[model samples]
Target: MRDTVIYAHRGLNHAAPENTLAAFAAASRSGVTWIETDTDILADGTAVIMHDSRTDRTTNRSGSIYDLTTSDLDTIDAGSWFSGDFVGERVPTLRELVSFLGPHDLNLNLELKGNTQGRDRSIRLVETVLEELRRLRPGTRVLISSFSPLLLAEVHRRTDAYELAWLVDKGTIGEDWRSVMELCGATALHPSTAVVSNRCVVEEIRRAGFGVNVWTVNSVQEANKLVNWGCTGIITDIADQMVEAGRRR
Candidate 1:
């Protein structure tokens, strides 16, 4: 369960653009104990921090991130859309971010992009990412997750696995939820904000011996309700507030 600590979703995403260095640095300063982020490889096979296939929502541009080279990625304005003060912020590569934050002993949750077409590419990408982690001056507390089962399985088959989680948006629980998750050696269940339909879903996952962590929950009340139902932790936009709220009660 990685210490049952709070994970700042895309850093302090509610206060800054998601997946930007400034947002992550802000989250670190805000007293958050953990942070979670997304990772996708560029056209050149450079891993970049991003949450979308398109840069439309967070940056001042419209294009697939996968289409850009790492150098080309620097030309885009990732922060200006959030505010003028952040106009020239460049997109960060995954290894760059790891070097920036890895020393703080913060827990990290890495969501694999699942876009690589072949099993070899998927494993190679994850291998590269982990190799970077290994080079950190201080070891990292890391977890690898993916929406694609194939990618998840590739990661599982190849290396010294971290806690793998299945990232589901629609709560599909498709085919066989347990079967699918079990195949990847998943230790947690990450479903969307809307799937907190009943306490049972949370309880069920936990009862089956997996940690339950929900994503992007910001409201204190919304977060409190989930914590009250026994969630292990929450990945939230308002990291400090959510942690404080959880601690208050």
Candidate 2:
């Protein structure tokens, strides 16, 4: 079997606040070469790394990302809620993340959060992300993913420079994943673990010339199963343990 890649989900969120620079550093220290993070834009059009539309869950302050400016976001303490060791950890901008990952041989799976405002905003967000990435070191590998077909399709239409993946849940696009991939022109599939439970499904995705990267797989047993079934990668919170598991396999 080929070596199964382990992507630190939100940069080892269990060690530090999710999507924070501290968390990303922790993941890299644990020897994880691939990391996954979510993206959202601020009021001033600065692309920041955050999973939620609202900052209430992750920061010391409460407000929607769209309602907050880059200056406003910089003031929030994003790490205290997770632990005392990571107090005052600021949420990073996409440009900051690109610079941070540029020196390392890391592959970033950036999931573009949906823009419900309008198609123009969505296009702008994608453009902003690409611009930041361009400023980084050459040959940085990035895979863009989204549940928003509109945004993903817009990105695909705009640039063939980056690889795109269509994110799917079991309830939505479980059986019809191929159609979603085709719709978005995705080169890979980021499906919830529930959808890839059947080994044949993994084989099917591989046969169709797409990589299957399963998300949120935490247990060693589950990780081993996915790896044995020919999954390309496992996105997980426990990068250290998963790395050990991959080594054992």
**Which residues of candidate 1, in runs, are more than 4 Å off?**
1-4, 116-121
**Candidate 2 on 46-89: residue-level lDDT in tens?**
99999999889999988688888888866899989998988889
Worst 10 residues of 2 by lDDT: 171-180
Candidates' TM-scores? 0.90, 0.95
**Error in Å for residue 150 of model 1:** 1.6
TM-score of candidate 2 versus the correct structure, residues matched by position:
0.95
Model 1: lowest-lDDT 10 consecutive positions: 131-140
Q: Which stretches of candidate 2 lie over 4 Å from their true place?
A: 174-176
Pairs of residues clashing in candidate 1: none
What RMSD does each model have against the real structure? Answer: 2.4, 1.5
For residue 84, what is the lDDT in candidate 1?
83
- Candidate 1: deviation at residue 23, Å? 0.5
